[model samples]
Target: MTDLLETLIENREMVQPNHANMLEVAHGGNVMKWMDEVGAMSAMRFSGETCVTAQVNRMDFERPIPVGDTAYITAYVYDAGTSSVKVRLITEREDLRTREREKTTESYFVYVAIDDENRPTTVPKLTVDSETGERLRQDALEGEIDGNSDKS
Candidate 1:
């Protein structure tokens, strides 16, 4: 059994001139790519197998990460089915020198565990045994609600 918190992953990338758009902020595509990578990592950790992205659900870009700022990405597996893991991803903009940070994006991604032959494989049961793990799950659920309500 894998605990949800055990699958949490955090990564940081600096937004350079090459990574920025004409607005001098990180490109939306680049941010999505980074989110996918981190989400896959979280799913793989929880499944203990290779994982491939199945869906990106309701990605919200709340703000932009300016050039020279760091993009802080955090992902964790909060749910799993027979062959799929659901990961919650959040991105924040940070100034390392000043240590100031603000969340800029969030999304829920799904990945399917795969076998050597690329067939879907069963994933371990996700456990939210710890307080932190439970809290993260709750937060993800709340985020989902918020994302969905915005469509109205």
Candidate 2:
């Protein structure tokens, strides 16, 4: 079993001119790419094997990350099956000067562990033993529920 907290991965990238779109905000594609990278890292950490993206459930870009601000990407493996790991990803816009942050995107990514032959491989179960781990998992679950409810 792997602790859910152990699978958490956080990364930040400063939005440069090249990474921005016409409006001078980080491009959607760039944000998705960053999310994928961090999500894969979280899955690999939990599985102890190379992981490849299987699906991206949803990506809601609620706000823009302006150039010169920091884009913080956070990911963690919240659940896993025989060979699949589900990760929750959240992207936030942070002003380095003031250390203020606001969420800009949220998504769930699924990854499958692979062996040397590129075949799907089994992964250990995810465990949420600590209070913080449980809270994180619960929060992700609630977010998913809230997102889905809004569609109706």
TM-score of each: 0.95, 0.95
Instruction: Estimate, for each residue in 23-125, the C-alpha lDDT of model 2 and write its tens digit.
Output: 9999999999999999999999999999999999889998999999999999999889999999999999999999999989899899999999999999998
**TM-score for model 1?**
0.95
Write the residue-wise lDDT of candidate 1 on 62-138 in tens digits. 89999999999999998899999999999999999999988899899999999999999999998898897888898
Q: Which stretches of candidate 2 lie over 4 Å from their true place?
A: 146-152
RMSD of each: 2.6, 2.5
What is the number of residue pairs that collide in model 1?
Answer: 0
Clashes of each: 0, 0
Question: Which parts of model 1 have CA positions greater than 4 angstroms off?
Answer: 146-152
Over the full model, what C-alpha lDDT does candidate 2 score relative to the true structure?
0.92
lDDT of 2 at 96: 94
Lowest summed lDDT over 10 consecutive residues: which window, candidate 2? 143-152
